[model samples]
Target: MQDPTATARPRKIIHIDMDAFYASVEQRDDPALRGRPVVVAWRGERSVVCAASYEARRFGVRSAMPAVRAERLCPQAVFVPPDFVRYKAVSRQVREIFLRHTELVEPLSLDEAYLDVTAPRSDLPTATAIAEAIRAQIRGETALTASAGVAPNKFLAKIASDWRKPDGLFVLRPHRVEAFLTPLPVERIPGVGKVMLSKLHAVGIRSVGELRQWPREELERLFGSFGGSLYRRARGIDERPVEPDQPVQSISSEDTFARDLPLHALDEAIARLAGKTWQATRRTERIGRTVVLKLKTAQFRTLTRSLTPDRPPASEEELRAIALALRDRVDLPADTLYRLVGVGVSGFRDREEAMTQPPLFE
Candidate 1:
């Protein structure tokens, strides 16, 4: 039988990402901060960088790095606390610009989004033109730079968006997809993190071309379900549609301590984080059934423990209890030091569905 996928019309997807979003906003608001290194983060030993301007990045500063390390990297950098209210306003303005072209806008975060313009509402004759227009409009209105990528699908478009930094656009026609992906590193594929990259390297698959040569069965046997994704991605296949107004997948709050602490010393932190996560969940009508506890070791190893109780926690205290209890499930040695802890809830269901579902044991 012929492949059904090949019969479908080619999609036009665009990924738009703002450059140094939080830091750029800080600089845009304060003329004095425009040329200097700007780091958006709180002034605390335990704080992590929310965003770093390109000036700071030249000195090895980056988002999510420890604030202390960022200070060491760029001592003269200007540190400013994050202002979500202002950032959110800017994001909304940019998102309005996207909606003017296509209703199929999927926001990845406040700083980036995917737009499916297979049948754009605007008169722009091509996806690339649409991308150019959007980027121009964003720059004109927000006084902030944005990068855009246009391709036949979301995966390639996302990768293309990063090909050029701050105020750039790249287009990947369908005919050029294979050639464009061949020499790229395996880690360039989404979901291929450091551990997955190491595993791929172990199998002598260091590039997309190498990954494409492996038999599907062999890859599946070695990496389970993810191997199938690798097999498809190597060939530039991504069928996920741009889902607009996507529901919340999870809610979480995490903290990195000023200093690493033993596992036994995390009770207070877990409780505090869980409370924050609980407050976030209150905004949604859905119920989250799984409680998850995440830990990052001083050595950078990350692990998570989760429990799906028959009923979801009903209060902040209950969520805190579940999160704290999950620590017992960790199998790490007592001497292991952890630098971060997080609490989260996932496996969400509509309120009615959660209330009406039958028990699993029954």
Candidate 2:
């Protein structure tokens, strides 16, 4: 009983992501950190990794790894606590960079965003050119690197963006969509996580090429409501629109360290992280009612604590206190070490004056 007229046509989409966003920014600012294994997080028994430089990634040091474990893998790694405020300032600069290209922009996260540049400024002949120009501008303005993916739809475009990384560009022409997807693993499709992969494997569907071989009816019978979606995606069909001016949801800062520090330094680390979070709030000019602290241990265990303040803290000292208080709540073994720490503010409110107020007498 589906209406044929309701089917949507595909559109051009591009996804752009900063390369190793936080760590890259750190390296860009501090020349000494470049080409070194840099982990942007504090070292302790209750910390988590926020970002890992490519050099660090080579030693199996990944985001969310414990500071102790990361050190075990790469003993010489450098660990630094997060400074979110600076990252947010940089993100705002990146957003302004996007606006110059097209109005149809959808930010997936601070480090990544999607743009519908089918119709772009300056009458660029192709989306690829627009992507190139944007990347160049980012490098010029921020001294940072970004990767771009251009495709016929958002799904494909997002995957393509990560194909060539650390200041690279990849374009998937409409004609090459099927070829590009066929050899890719099913996991490349956004929602095909561990659970979905097992189901597909049980049915001998290991790759996009195999998934494409299933009859629509069989796929529908097996996956039920998700079958049609899977089938269409197998063929690179996506119809999502690029949305602009989505409301801000949260602001946060985190870092993964190269080495674990003693637990006693936790207070100093939290203070630095709090300052960073405050900067992000100022750049976005949004106040939040809730504050969150994230930690990852040396064994890669993750933990979070949050506090909803009666009113948002008006100063960095207040922010640090809330974060340090949350840190005390986490349970760490006497000898445990951490690899990362993060602070975030969410539940935003506007500063603008309201036109009407409720009557107090009522």
C-alpha RMSD of each candidate structure in angstroms = 2.6, 7.6
Return the lDDT, model 1, position 304: 95
Candidate 2 displacement at residue 102 in angstroms: 0.5
What is candidate 2's lDDT per residue for 1-362, written digit by digit as tens? 12111335446678999999999999999999999999998887556688899999999998877677887888899887899999999999999999998989898878999998877865778788889989999999999999999988788899999999878999998778878888999988988888889999999999999999998899999988788888888888777778898766788888766677545566777789899998888877656767888887877678888887656778888988988888887777767777778898876767441112221210
Worst 10 residues of 1 by lDDT: 1-10
Off by over 4 Å in 2: 1-10, 216-226, 248-362
lDDT of 2 at 136: 92
Residue 112, candidate 2: alpha-carbon lDDT: 94
TM-score of each: 0.92, 0.67
